[model samples]
Target: MSYKILAVNPGSTSTKIAVYEDEKELFSESIVHSDEELKKYQKVTDEFDMRKETILNSMNKHGVKEKDLSAVVGRGGQLVNIHAGGYLVTQDMKEKLVDASTIEHASNLGALIADAIAAPLGIPSYIYDAVGSDEMKDIAKITGMPEIVRESFCHVLNSKAMARKVAAKAGKSYQEMNFIVAHLGGGISVSAHERGRIVDAIPSDGGPFSPERSGSIPLNYIVDMCYSGKYCKREMTKKITGMGGIKAYLGTSSCLEVEKMIEAGNTQAKEIFEAEAYQIAKGIGELSPVLKGKIDAIILTGGVAHSKMLTDWITDYVSFIAPVVVMPGENELESLAAGALRILKGEEQADPYKK
Candidate 1:
């Protein structure tokens, strides 16, 4: 029997919904909500109700009823360090993804969107590989100082895709290859994948800031910044996650603009962009020993992976370990749907992404 699936990837401002009948898409919509409309709600939790209701309105406008749905799926959120894949959803998962204390990322609202619509209709809602999607080896997990903190990382989606593609070229499965995958978008994530899992990664909260993220700041410095009568937890959230990074340095988020400036002989832009790419290259270098020098590929993925300039930069430096492969563009929608297919086929046991 064919089933109609309603999949969602709700972000901080926009909500994207895709309805599919088996392998064919029936309906798709992207709701680019106004900031004013979004800001009307005082808190991120408040926005949850608004976004869910909006998606409902969208479905209804298209004459799609919740009762007619087959499966429900949404993005995963509230995870700090996680690998990426389709994680099936459950009630226990819900509590883990939502935190009144910690502000929500765009992904946080994924479950809420599904819960608002699917539960009433009695449809099963699944979170396909919300985070924590790859496998890392035992030793990669042990590159630690022992005690106090162990480095754990996720956001393994594109990286895994990259590994699979390169592995096929070498007549190997992803599990049989050792690779370092770097996802360079607004935020940068570098991970080491061995035997099909990402066991080691650099956490944004751990270090290396990105275009919009603050990356890792020293604890003592953060404490001083907090007490200097200049910042609050709220302000810090905006700075670190939103207004900081490349924009903090250059007043814009467009890498296109940054590249333009660099081409026009803007030394500072060249310096920052090169520095960011160099740091990512170095991130791959750091993961080599973890792979025990069995590196087969260095992968570049994410939005910034589309940048020829950036990919070439990383390739030039990281080529010493292995030939670099670039998987261009953000495939979150296809990725989301691909995950649902994996679960439906029983290739993966659904472990819904919760809070």
Candidate 2:
């Protein structure tokens, strides 16, 4: 049986839309939104109509009719923490998507766009592997201080997808293996997948420094900086996640540019690049104990995983823990479609988001 699914993924500056018939993709497009164009909206939620119109236009241009769609799936945004799986979009979920306090990301627009298009046709809208999906164990929640607790806000959609892929390649079920999957991208997330459940995660904003995010910083120094009056709260927040990492040190977030500089004998560039690998390896080491060092495989994925130079550095340090698997780039759009298809085929059950 064939099912037609539309997957919508909104990013910081672009919206990715794809149409899939069962497992095969009919067509996909990434609509780029310029910084200046996005500047017109005060919040990411404000651009909902603009993004929805763009998606409809793209679908019309591609001859994708609403009547042919079996369902519309979207990239999950931050909501109340729930299990990892496809969720039927509800009115409560839509409300949380537009709540800035819940999550202030372009991805929040994903469900809104999907619902607007799907609702008129009476087709169900769903979201799979939401970023806020939390499966962390109780012990992993404590953070030494009573006031703060760790959140499982990593790249759940991509990390979990890679885990299943690697498990399949190993001729084993994901439920039968323990693995540490690192999603190295614009923002980095390293997580421990125990058996089939993600028991721990080093969220992108708090884990190893990535292309643009600062990762973990010295607590005392950050406190001092907050009181220093040199930067406001908004600026400070941007500094930690956007203007941090290599962008903060060498003034560029492009890993390819850093590699070019390293090839030209730029010692500072090479050192900082290696430093990032070092931090990533350290994160892997930290999570090894979470699985009691019984990790089956260490999978590396995402756009940054395309760089062998960086991957090599990370591999050299963590190879002893487990064999490394490098799966480059993200398959989020296809993953979303596949997830929705699974529910359609009764291969997997869709989980509900309880308000």
Candidate 3:
């Protein structure tokens, strides 16, 4: 009854592939694409063949037989809003991913590469917990401005996976537990999971500033800065995301480096690091009301969650809401495989991709 699965996760500069037999990982490989190499492609989708080839070669090197794989699961990409779950990789989904007008992201290549490899083998290819999955209530979308509506754009894959993991550890099903998962990484996403669905979330843009993102900023200040002619649209966008937060404050983005600076008695670094932790705690607090104070556990995950200094600071601030369980690392590949396995084992049904 064991099933072999191949999970593909494409990031901005790397393609991570893994093979799992049931719940056990056989091998995992991360294929790094340098800036010079990636610059040859005008669009992210254009690198499909190259990425797919590299993945196949890695699998071959790892002694994985293509025909033996029961299913191929990929990290979901930017598409129209959909629910959080596994979806069969269909032609319609591929079309949406390649649409030129939509945002270009490296993740869009996941399904394409997966389908290319799985289709000839006559096996199903699926995308689990896609980036565009939105399960928020309509009320949560409201904003003070009529033109702007909040959208659910948190780290859906990792957050939901951690929620399920915590639920399992507590001897409960994910559908029977309520949890708030804070994914603290380069960007931070604090999500409120009610029952089995993510009811609401503080997406990286709307939540606390992280190591590389500005998160929520004063609108008036942003407007003034935009009109002030000191920067252009692209520069402003980078400031709000890539070049903001800790890097903007102290000239580096590595949490480890920041912690070292604090140990070296750098007052400014310590203050900025504490502020990041404070904002994360505030974001977690904001989602508590969304779950009605009935949260079973507050899970801390993602790369930055590995930092004891940061986690301890956050735990000290929000321990009253619920017990904080720090489960670090992204673990995206395993999550993708598990999602597909649930569907394959008939424990959960795979959702269809609409639009």
The count of residue-pair clashes in candidate 1 stands at 27
Each model's lDDT comes to 0.75, 0.91, 0.93
The best-first sequence of candidates by lDDT reads 3, 2, 1
lDDT by residue (1-355, candidate 3, tens digit) is 9999999999999999999999999999989999999999998988999999999999999999999999999888887578889899998888888998667899988888889999999999999998778899999999999999888888999999999999988899999999999999999999999999999999899989999999999999999999999999999999999999999999999999999999999999999999999999999999899988999999999999989999999999999999999999999999999999999999888865656
After superposition, which runs of candidate 3 have C-alpha atoms over 4 Å from their true positions? none
Candidate 2: give the clashing pairs: none
At residue 60, candidate 1 shows an lDDT of 92
What lDDT does candidate 1 reach at residue 148?
51
**What ordering of candidates by TM-score runs from best to worst?**
3, 2, 1
TM-scores vs. true structure, each candidate: 0.84, 0.97, 0.98
Candidate 3 has an lDDT of 0.93
Question: Candidate 1: what lDDT?
Answer: 0.75
Cα distance off (Å), candidate 3, residue 232: 0.5
Model 2: CA > 4 A from native = none
Residue 170 in model 1: shift from native, Å?
5.5
What's the CA error at residue 104 for candidate 2, in Å? 1.8
Q: Is candidate 1 or candidate 3 better by TM-score?
A: 3
